[model samples]
Target: MQKNSGKSVLLLFILLIVSTLSAGCTDNSSTSQTIQTSEETSTRTLTDALGRTVEIPESVDYVICSGVGSLRYLTYLEAQDKIIGVERSETTNSASNAKPYSLANPQFSTDYPVFGETRGMDDPEKILSLDPLPEVIIKTYSATGFDPVELQEKTGIPVVIVNTGDLADNKEDLYESLRIIGEVVGKEERAEEVISFFDENIADLKERIADIPEEDKPTCYVGGIGRAGGPQGFQSTEPTYPPFLFTNAINVAYGDMDINVADVSKEKIIEWDPEIIFLDLNTIECGEDRSGLRLLQNDESYRQLQAVQSGNVYGVLPFNQYATNFGSVLADSYFAGKTLYPDKFEDVDLENKTIEIYTFLVCKGDEELGREIYNTMINVYGTPAFAKLDI
Candidate 1:
């Protein structure tokens, strides 16, 4: 009986030891799993518009956009809520500040902080000083002198490069840039919507004008197109202007020029002698000194042109402020179509069409807000004095 009792005691002791060891192993395994989960949730990799593979946070909550159109693209994605800072140009209030993105996002100027110089200059000090250090910095390809890899290394933040295409020619770059931004911001669906909206509008415009014969297309010239604030007279023009291109109008400014906006001699203007003239209202808004409309109105040389004498001259909203106001570009195209080929665009309503384009792009489809923006562009502020002509 004594031997049997001792055997039972030994067996119980061994069982207790085994139970403790199992518990310890379970705790260690649980700790390892927790550490792995934390690492997985910490960071993710993405390819930016510049094709640089960057590791960003798994969830990007705060950001700063540099360059001319970085913030504008963000606005299109409806991720403006993530922006922690803006460029200096966004803070300034002006009638000429016709960027629909800015008009749609009023809080950017009133609430958010401005960082560094305009057009995406490197101000690492200011960026670091932000209250909540931005997790990422977005920049446009146009932001010169700032290298993305160097900037990322200096700030220890992921820098994503984006391209803001001219919208006239390099539209594919713009679409790709939007997709990259959507991936980074986790708004892929909204980005697709924006791209679709632009594509549909452009396609519709083209389809409407496609059947028109080349000989029937009106010869057109757009002048006083603003570029980096300078001496803009009647000769400043966009060679590949969006309005003329989309409407299928003949742009007499078209030539083998290396730049979009360039100066043409008054003699060249008289030589081409386009039937219709669209004055960019920006030159007049810049004040009397830079007013190309004023030159066209007062100059006897301009009076000799057929478009001027026959009252075919019209005013178009400035679409080139701080980059391109894409909404204005589309709106200008419709207006140009209506004016140049009135019978073709007879079914189109300018006010309703402008509202539709603006609603799709900005202000969340608010027709009233669309009208306000449109009025600011064509009627209220930027309209040239000569636009009152009886054409």
Candidate 2:
């Protein structure tokens, strides 16, 4: 009976040992699975602000700017090296910054040579004719009928829609747009630099104007005086346009002024009779040198206005830097301060400020030219318009 009991105990011990080995193997297998899951999640792809799911590529090299001015930011960030192609307009001699650079250095725009204008984003056939595919397409939009989603569906390439509404409203949108583009193009650091420069300059301009009293703030007006392509000179009196919004100054014609931009009649302008006139260089008078602004200043009907007498009128030419020209917001602010208390900003230097904005937007740093554009007009229209409008 004792020998049989001892044998049973030894059998029980062997069974226990086998059970322990099996449990250990199961635990190790589970740990291995958890580690594999973590690795996969780390590399997982995500969607961007434009609502497109983009996988972070091992490296992003080739790029194409789908809409106008998209390439300007890319070039500003120094990421032009990664661009494979750009719209024909972007490569044109008329495009200012990009054109001169592209001409001097063939390599400037030739990384990938794309032919055709910037207006054909929806033309898949034209895009396809380019043959080689771009990994990404960046575009801008307003109320236009061309749907970005449809374009994406037509072409296998992913389309990222950038909302340009902010260009007409606030500064936050500008920074946000930059960050989104940077992420798409893998130029995050460069984007941050551009944003920082914009923020710092804006802050400085505000600081200089803070001491002025609210009652004394200069009343201001911002708009484009001449249309470049129109058979007759064009007046962009529309309150919703870029020149008005980016300037951040009060538009005399915006709220109760009853001005019609589409009709673009000088009769409409005479009724508004804004104290401070801001001219867009592309206006009908573009090639006429200061002719557009001069016409408005010398027009017999406008001679009685305080602005024409005091020299408060100014003109800003549209280009990559001023093309979007958020700096005009600061220009508006500085001009307002000077009008309110000429003594305070006497040393503030509007000319220098103009240069700073141009420099920030493009490497050309045309400070003198910026001052020249403003002075040529401001001298003609006097300061009363700038003074009468509360900025």
Candidate 3:
């Protein structure tokens, strides 16, 4: 019985060793499965501005903006650091003050790599060659340039489309765009704050002049409005100009035109002879012969207008530098409110308000930085960019 007990102990040790070997083999297979599952779980889906459901990385740290105002949105989010590259137009020396976002972050033109030409015309080759390759492409305007879907297929990166809805009637759409972008870059809170800021400002602008009698409202007109190509002449204007809407000032061009924007006849201007004439500073870019400022100051027809005679003509920042400079739009609204209704906005300081709007929107609450950008803007466009015209 003692001999059999020793043999039993040896057999039990051998069986234990065999079981350990089998468990080790099972663990190796399980590890491979876990790595495979990890790869599969690395991505999640997103619904973009176009209502297209797209699959994007669960953790996105780098991206490229492919459309007009796309980089502007990034600046608004204060997430411009996440941008791996940008469009070529943004880096150009021409029209330096055209896009305030570009001016606010000069690094966008110099430090980051170039992705493609302006207006979403992406070059997939350039995109793929970027160091530390981007994880996604965010686009705003799609009417022209590379289609987001095709660009995604060519570059092998998720392309997320967003909208920079017009600042006026479609403003809610713009808010949704901001929120969508915020979600992608982990700036959800910032996006909501921006929307709230716009809402609060709009409400305040409206309330300040709400009690003013309609008969007391002065007739207003805006000209030299910039468009897709470049600066237009004094005759060019927007009927639904956002600044006009914000200040509740009556725009003579608002209901007279068949389209949202067009060049009104000089004869019509002589007829309406708006009590207040607001010229877009971009008109200075129209060259000596074509400049809106040149026309207002030199042209016999424009000089004869009542606003010009009374020195009611004022200079407002251009909001349409590359499809609506959102920050500039807000800034212009404040100036318009103050100029048209001094009594209502007597407490408002133009310089301080400009700094506040630029800081909150582009400088991320850095008051000093906002002040610097404002100074740079006026320097480029001249002091008349946001004040009473010498005319």
| Model 3 alpha-carbon drift over 4 Å, by segment | 1-33
Best by TM-score: 3
TM-score against native, each model: 0.87, 0.65, 0.91
Query: Model 3, range 102-165, lDDT digits (tens) per residue?
Result: 7778888789889898888889899999997998889988667997778888988988889879
Ranking of models by TM-score: 3, 1, 2
Per-residue CA lDDT of model 1 for 287-312, tens digit only, reads 67557777777788888889988888
Query: Which window of ten consecutive residues has the lowest lDDT sum in model 3?
Result: 255-264
Overall lDDT per candidate, in order of appearance: 0.80, 0.53, 0.85
Candidate achieving higher lDDT, 1 or 3: 3
Candidate 1 versus truth, CA RMSD in Å, comes to 4.3
